[model samples]
Target: MGINKERSAWEKVNMARAQERPSAKQYIDRIFDNFMEFHGDRNFGDDPAIIGGIAQLDGRSVTVIAQQKGENTKDNIFRNFGCPHPEGYRKALRLMLQAEKFGRPVICFVDTQGAYCGIGAEERGQGEAIARNLVTMMNLKTPIISVVIGQGGSGGALALAVADEVWMLENSVYSILSPEGFASILWKDASRAQEAADIMKLTAEDLLSLKVIDRVIMEPNGGAHKNIDAMATILKDRFISTLEKLCSLEEDKLLMKRYEKFRKIGYYKE
Candidate 1:
């Protein structure tokens, strides 16, 4: 009968407004010039959850994939708050493949709670779709870079994150599973989610220390939402620098580094 603090925190952070928050799309529009959007997976219906397009970052051509959360009730239903269904990931895969075919570098903005787990999504093979994206991304020929702008949970996040260099905002989270889900499975009580979150090591700082992420992009003092323009500028600079470094590498060397990067993710010795 009392208030649930964990649920409150989860909702407060997760349900924060797309308009109020400094979103990835806003940054892309303001910072990147000559942007052009592409649509649909071609095999299925178009998904508003994932937005992919071509953009010029400091005058260099690049492909951008962003997980878009909606601004209002109707748009929320459309974008699904950045939670991609199977088709959405497929759409992303199509764009990534396009970028590779054209030898264009890819930039991904990740901001998803997880892949859509609805009955419809399952029927459409959401898990298979995510797995396929991971496999294809691992072997992608063109340079790939990812930025975790907000919630990057489970396979939804992983699909876009198989990049040569990964960056995470200071306050963003990346995890294999949500804390509530983890607590439900591990402790048999969802009320212990806070404890699970502490154990999961989902924070950007923790991942950076573990080498799960290549770098941490600092947000404004209050948060990214407070100073959107400043945050966008910082990200723009980092993206330019990272892409330049990746572009300098030969395909074979870049692929080798990417392979090694993922290989070291869970490596430990006692």
Candidate 2:
């Protein structure tokens, strides 16, 4: 979507969560040549909320990791509505480490409301798992790129987003928390989520201006669901161009720039 100042942030939020919007599986199919999905975290089990694998992007092998949500109630339950657990984060990190080992570029897609907050998830060390991903990705040797294709909420999204470059779809939102959560915690009124959205600066346009994201991938006039092919085409081009630039750098330089990218993400004036 083109930058539309008139579109309220909350409306964009709704669009990002639309069921008809093509999910990570859809994007992976269209953008990559052959995808071989890997399973399990080695310790606990496999997680459907996250899908990771080896794929050929423009004839170059790359690791593809993405958070996935289902289109219907049954599938959503199976996927935990794309809210991953500790195992999901571990799976992502494992695939990332594999990428580093094979000298392959890592591409991540973030689209989660947050990690699963259920008692069972906490019992399995969800926080620790997410934290480990952050530490590992920060120092990983391979070039990495992450795109927020939909709801990138909380630490769950951040777990997969510590990359050399982070992009966001025009209608997507990447925030520390949902506006409802912010309003509920701050004002004790979840109904004031619209108000919270106005101040959160979660939109791709807002994030790019704030230096929170590297670029904004334009969607259709309404959203990605309006024209999935067009959206994926633009996204594929951006990925290829960026990957070429990143893969050209020396390994040490690649790591340094990724480090500096996060260090420079602040809202203050120079």
Which runs in model 2 stand beyond 4 Å of their true positions? Answer: 265-270
Candidate lDDT scores, in order, read: 0.83, 0.93
lDDT digits (tens) for residues 41-146 of candidate 2: 9999999999999999999999999999997899999999999999999999899999999999999999999999999999999999999999999999999999
Q: List the residue pairs that clash in candidate 1.
A: none
Cα lDDT tens digits for candidate 1, 1-270: 212223333433353323566667788897788888888888878888999899889889899998888766788788987799999999999999999999899999998889889999999899999999999999999999999888888889999999999988877788988888999999899998877877787777778888999888877766678888889999989988888988988898788888888998442212
What's the distance in Å from true for residue 32, model 2? 0.4
* Candidate of highest lDDT: 2
Error of 1 at 184 (Å): 1.6
